[model samples]
Target: MRSFFMPFAIYVLGLAVFAQGTSEFMLSGLVPDVADDLHISIPAAGWLTSAYAVGMVLGAPLVAMLSIRWPRRRALLIFLLTFLLAHVLGAMTSSFEVLLGTRIVAALANAGFLAVGLAAASAMVGSQAKGRATSVLLSGVTLACIAGVPLGAVLSEFWGWRSAFWAVAIVSVPAVIAILCAVPASAVDPNAPTARHELRALRTPRLAVTLLLGALVNGATFCTFTYLAPLVTDVAALSTNWVPVALALFGIGSFVGVTIGGRFADTKPLQLLTIGAIALLGGWLLFALTAANPITALALVFVQGTLSFAVGSTLIAQALYAATDAPTLAGGFATAAFNVGAAVGPVLGGIAIDAGLGYRSPLLVSAALVALALVSYSVARNAAHRSNHSRGRSPESF
Candidate 1:
């Protein structure tokens, strides 16, 4: 019974993540519709994406600290409900200001749910399976990219952008019910680390570097991903009808990447990160150069997406592992780190475009960020080696 129920509970959590991740990413496809509907400039509309990310960055640690002592099921349910409410409000609001407010509220709810959900999923599995568990949760996000994001674009194209919000709200209902029925109260640790201990975990150099790596990798991803619609149609010279296809292909690659990362990350984290980052940088560079060719651009989009998520998911598992001493807040730290990248990436991409760098600028921006990520990894590897040497440990022990 425990075995049967555990996977069901984890997938339910993933379902909730699917709903939130849909909301988080669907905006990339709806940017023009949102701008036209709200009578805002395109860049201004793009800021909505940044706003959600910013809220996540602030909300993750805040919600984690506040719910440190609460029952895991209770925290998850409350956040899930708040997310539903925010979407409903967003769907009902025509005023951009109100919509922005809704996005922030929704993001707070998303951040809380993700932090709690990751902790809960990891706790349910054995130590050896933590990477697999993390992948299961993140798979929802990849699946969202595959189906929800493209469907949101289709819905927006046909029924209007608000329908996308309504769809997310509707999808979240089943997840709420599942959580209530399937999640056990014991998911929460009664003697969870104090908030101080959780914060102290951040001071570890290795953990800090891991978090930075997550930020850089995710930043590179969103920098390109957030502007994919424009890149497909404007730069690649594809029809608007190709936007969803491009997005779906990227999603497909992400799903594949996450699966591969999850399979090997437990035993070969450093190698996965190292190779994935290099390949991702090369993919981004190739994308920038060939973005004018529709076919090549589309193909590279898929390749870059795979490499991006492969590295991104591994970084997430690494962050959680490095912060093992602060089990309760481990997810929060990872959440905050990735969203920091999410927030900054698009903003920088937008700035580049605004400065007349062209639609391909985001691809170049992504490449640069990945390059920096590679350098950071080298620094981290050397530092790990020096520390391990002093302790008479193998470098691979890192």
Candidate 2:
């Protein structure tokens, strides 16, 4: 019963994440349509995306704190319902302002759902399998990047942008039903950490660095990903049609990365991080230097995506492990940290481009970020080693 139910519940949570992540990422492809339909400029429509990121960053910790005492299943249900309603409202809205408001609301729901969902999924598995469980949950987001975003674009192209919103809301219905049936009432834990205790746990040095590492690594990925279209069409000299293909390839690589990396994350996290960071830095640098060559650019995009998520997923698991004392809020910390990177990466990349650094500049920016992440990892590892030695534990225990 435990075996059957655990995987089933985790997959159900992943399905919910798929629905939410589709809405989060599909906007990039639908932005032009959204602007035209609402009679807003493209730049204004782009704010819808930014608004979602802002909501996630602010809402994750806030909602996690507020719902700390709630049953995981109950909190998840509420968040999923809010998410569904936001999409419905968004689909019905004619005004850009109303649409923007709906995006924020949906994002808040997404943030809360993700935080709670991560905690729930992690709790379902043993310590050794936590990384694999995290990957399974996050695989939904990867699938969103691969299939959902493209499907949304196609739907918008045929039936209008609102149809995409409707599609998300529609698909989420099954997830809502599954949650009701699959998520056990036993998910509630009376011994769960209180908000104050969770807050104090955030002060842990290892956890702090882990969260920062997640942000840095994710920022690097997004900084390059955000500008992939320009890189493909302008720098690589590929046709505009090749953009989606490149994006899809990146998504595919990410899926592969997470699936493979998750297996080793719990047993060899430090090694995964060390190798992934170095490989990512080298990959990004090579991409920057060879982006004008179409074949090399496309290949490197896939490689970079693989390395990024391999490391990124492991960082998330590390955060959960490090925050073992704050089980309730660990997921929120991870969510907020990743979203912070999502918000900041593109801005810095845009700044570089505005300074005439060209399409390859973002790749360089990614490399630099990875370099910093590597330094952080080194410092953390050394500190952990010293602490372990002082406590008479073998360095291998770290």
Candidate 3:
């Protein structure tokens, strides 16, 4: 086995993957800027976010299952190249429709990139370091919240949303180069045994429940967060400049949440997920009630972002536990489901606002989704315990 500095590999891979992420999420804060520049409605601008996630949902597992036999490094390189080219296309395009179309293309690569990246990152270090490496990769996502998103928003304010795409284009190329240079080539065989094994893993009751929990939890979080900028600026009376800072603060919160949540995920991942969803419900409710005050509203927003994304590493950890026989496929599939949640959040929130439900209604709806997920988890847990008890006894003994 070749020796690799887990931290450096993580930093490089995470940054490369982070560029892909920021390309998707930075659009959330820049919606108004994008709308104004393209002469489109804000609802239309939101499709850019939805389109990217839709691509991820369609791409992640489809690629993962199909490429099961390919070398990991080669697959990643192909994905990264496409991811970079999509941004280049976005930067040069003038039509909002073309931009939206390009975003979906980018997501195809982005989802495959992340699914492969998670597998590669896990292989970087020793066994004990797997959770930490996953956390570090996900931390890239948290970093985008602090550094990438705010910077994108500021650039959009000055140079228009095109500048944001240009920034994404610039960073993506170098990251792609570094990834290609640094990552060692490795393959996971997709022969009948592995295929049959993963198919069996997918059929497991625990794995199904875990993916369900992920969709519900993620849908709950995004249902409010995708519209967070609009809620802060239009409904809460904050200046546009403040959107950057608020986003940065929210990123900081996510940093704390993920670090703390990462540790808990290893020990009792599913239990932690239920707890995280409860926190999400509380955060959304608080946001809905207090969004009228700028300072208080931003505080809740930061807390919401922090708590929700912090739960991510935990959720992935849960999926791995549930599908231990097929970590890569589970990771890819669960993440695609999470991407589906992202697609739903902005589109639903944007529609609610457009329909005159008011900005706060989205947060309220998020609260309800969280509440529903919480109940579902409780029932699942109870049923699991009962099943265990039933299995412990002999059927003929009675």
Candidate 4:
């Protein structure tokens, strides 16, 4: 703990993950290239992204449980190496089958990195610093939306689509080195868990609620954001130039909210969620109304990204409290929810858009989902409060 770089290890891990994320999402813009190269349709090429997310959801908990008994630092190293190798495989492969296989392999490795990295960051810092620590680790994800994916877009624009994979491979090497050097060895739990322990953790009602809530919450947000570029272009009447700025502002908001939200969750989880949930509804309402106004619409979009993303850390904290018996499994499952949303959101949003209801439909749907979540949480919180009162204990006693 005395090591100053110990906490900063979160940042190091963030960069490595940023590279991995770029590798996964960079394919969005490369759909045309993949289609032409593989003699497939643009829609078919989108499967690369779908395959990766599927692998993440499928791989997350399984890898988390298996790797629990291993040292966190060592597990993280192996995960990074596996991620790097997947990029290399993509770089080398010409066959679409090979590419899909490579992506699924990379996704499995990425899941391990995400699950272990967050847990490691938590173990490194004291309870008081959890908010800030989670913020630092989460900043990587924010950057993925801001810098990493955009940078990969640049790579595809200038170089061939395949070359983007090479760039990620090159970038990941230094991140791996940095993580290995910066992350303190003694900062890991020696006794992570066995498969039996992780299974026991998943049975808790509170944990299940939190994880399901995480999935629903994230799906609500991404259902809107996955179509943001199109919204700004078609509705906001802006060129692609401003999309980067919009995403950056949103990422900054999310990054800031993480620190603030983490602190709030630590002291006032229910109150903070209610406030943010209210704001989330307002944010979408503004986006839906002013989506034709570029400046205001961008601001509204940024608001959605910020408040919505910060909800994750709060939910993670709630899940941790629920699964006191098996934090590792809960942590990994929570991460999986984020990936699940990543998969479900875009598909649903696309269908809504295709039905001629237009791009703003996703925003409306998200607002409704958030409203439902708010109501659900209220009931759950009240029940827990009453249960605690009957036992002559505090709701925070867990």
Candidate 5:
């Protein structure tokens, strides 16, 4: 029964995720055009991205609380409809303020969709397959980074930035249809915990620590990633033309890393995190030292990208496992944590740059954050082991 329904469920959910991620990231490519069209400066245009991130940080828990008792399929449908409508508004808007508002609405919808999609995908599988299922869903975002962003940039270049928004709305129409047709309208569990209960579940020490680790991991990755273009052109002394190529390479590395990470996450989550930490330490150290050379910079960028995403599936699995009593709320909180880190990482990196650190300094900040994450993870694991031992059980019993 699990085998038969799981694949179809994951596939439909992945498509929905692809649609949401495309909307989220395509804005990166359209910011300049948007600034010009709306008579705003580029930095002011950048707030559109920040607005979306803030929406995600706030919306995940808010929407999760509101819809926790609703049927997953129904909630998903509502979220998708909201997302599509927001994009339509975004495309048709003439004022920058209107566009910003539309983006915030869209991101709120995206956060709801992602949280529900992750929980539903994991529920379709046994514990052993949860990691793989999550990876499949997240692949949507990775694929968006690789192809959707570049294509959106191209469209904006030839037509207008609004064209790209219209295209996303158009593509999302089929995705909404796919969800309706392919996903079953299952009944909600009668004994399922309420949103308040789920929120309480977050008080577990291991769950709290794991969520913190997840946030730090994301902060580490985005600290450098948000500044990658400047580092490439200013420090690596590469042509500005190479920025897109470098982005594509990083996307490729992310795809591969997520694929590999998903496979081992269920059975060897601790091992996966350990390896990811080591990779981050080594990769970023080399990246910081070699940014002055184009060849070394490119090679290390791909490597760092792979290592950066290596813990993604495992981190989600860990959070869900720790919060098994309240999976939906846990999932929402995890999404919020990641977005919070995404918003904060860039600010921290900008501060470093303002303090007279070179462009390569962000990579150093990335390495330090990852190292701290590794330390935090070790402490959590040891404490979990001690608790298990006191109960005369192995930690693996989890």
Candidate 6:
């Protein structure tokens, strides 16, 4: 097996993830600037974010299935280059419609990059180390939240939103260069499963249940998280400066959780998932109860972030195991599931808020979703166990 230091290829993939993630997350901070510059309403500007999520939901499985026969390294490079070009077009576009289109294109490229990157990372190491490799690849998103997202926000604040897009394009240049140097041109699998096979894997009962569990877990987190700013301001009663501090704390917790989760992902995935969900459920309940206390609310925010990411890597590992026959496509499906949840979460939370349920109401909604996720996982795990027992085989973990 290759030593950890030899994974220059995975590091390059991480760079690609960071570059794409910066583009995805920076938009939230740049919404006001984008709206003002384009003379669009705030809600219209917000739709740009929605467009990116929609693209991701559609693009992940689409790209994975389309590129099933391509060399993983080549697919990674292609996606990175497309992402670079999309950001350049985004920076240059003046029309809101044009900008929205660019975001969708960029998001497609981002989805392709992530799906192929996971397959590449898993292939690089022994099966036992696949979980660790996944964590390293996914660390890019958390690291972006900690640094790249804030840097983009600052760039948008000082120069302009277009400058932030330009910055993403510029950073992508190094990522593309790194991948070119580090990622080898491996041979494509001529006997790779057809699109039909990939689709069939999705139809498997266990895989379908796991995907739904992923979606629910993600939705539970975002239900409250999508409205975090308002919750902090109106309920937590913190000043604007503290909002950034709170966000930083959440990022820090995520970084910690992913690292810890990676250590156990291979051997204790089911246990970790259950514990993480319980922690998250408790964390949200605490958050709802303590929103009036600024310090406690901020502390719970960090806890929630930790719990949110802790289960995430393990869930991806679970999905990969469940769909071993179609791992790459499974990764894409998992990405789509999470995005679907992310898209729906904010809408549900928004409805509650519009009904005058208050900012903390989102936390209640989040907790309910967490309960549903737990129930879903339990059902899936038990079904797998029963089927395995009937076949005279040991049951697999959830």
**Candidate of highest TM-score:** 2
Off by over 4 Å in 6: 1-6
| Prediction-by-prediction clash tally | 0, 0, 0, 0, 0, 0
After TM-score superposition, what is the CA distance of residue 16 in candidate 2 from its true location, in Å?
A: 0.9
RMSD of each: 2.9, 1.9, 4.5, 2.6, 1.8, 1.6
Tens-digit lDDT track for model 1 on 116-160? 898888877856566777888899999998999889988999999
lDDT of 5 at 170: 84
Best by lDDT: 2
What is candidate 1's CA lDDT for residue 347? 85
Model 2 TM-score?
0.97
Instruction: Give me the overall lDDT of model 3.
Output: 0.75
Reference-based TM-score of each model: 0.91, 0.97, 0.85, 0.92, 0.96, 0.96
Clashes of 3: 0
- Residues 231-267, candidate 6: write the lDDT tens digits: 8889988888788888888888878877777778877
Which residue runs of candidate 3 sit more than 4 Å off their true CA positions?
1-7, 29-46, 93-101, 125-130, 156-160, 187-197, 233-237, 350-357, 389-398
Candidate 2 RMSD to the correct structure: 1.9
Residue-wise C-alpha lDDT for candidate 5, range 1-398, written one tens digit per residue: 23423467687777777777787888887888999999999999999988999999999978877889989999899999999999899999898999999999999888888888888877878666777888888888888888888888888999999888888888788878888887778898898889888888888988888778888888988899899999999999999999998998889888887787777777778778888887888888888988999999998878877777778657877788888778778888889988877877778888899999989889988888888888888887888898999999878633
Shift in Å, residue 263, candidate 4 = 3.9
lDDT of 3 by residue, 231-334 (tens): 87988998887876776777888777777666666555655676777788888888888898988987887788777876766676566656656756776897
Whole-structure CA lDDT of model 5: 0.84
Worst 10 residues of 1 by lDDT: 1-10
Point out the higher-scoring one by lDDT: 2 or 6.
2
User: What lDDT would each prediction earn against the true structure?
Assistant: 0.88, 0.89, 0.75, 0.77, 0.84, 0.84
TM-score comparison, 3 vs 5, better candidate: 5
Model 4 per-residue lDDT tens digits across residues 243-310: 77777777777666666666666567777677888888788877888889888987787677778877
Considering only N, C-alpha and C atoms within 3 Å, which residue pairs clash in candidate 1?
A: none
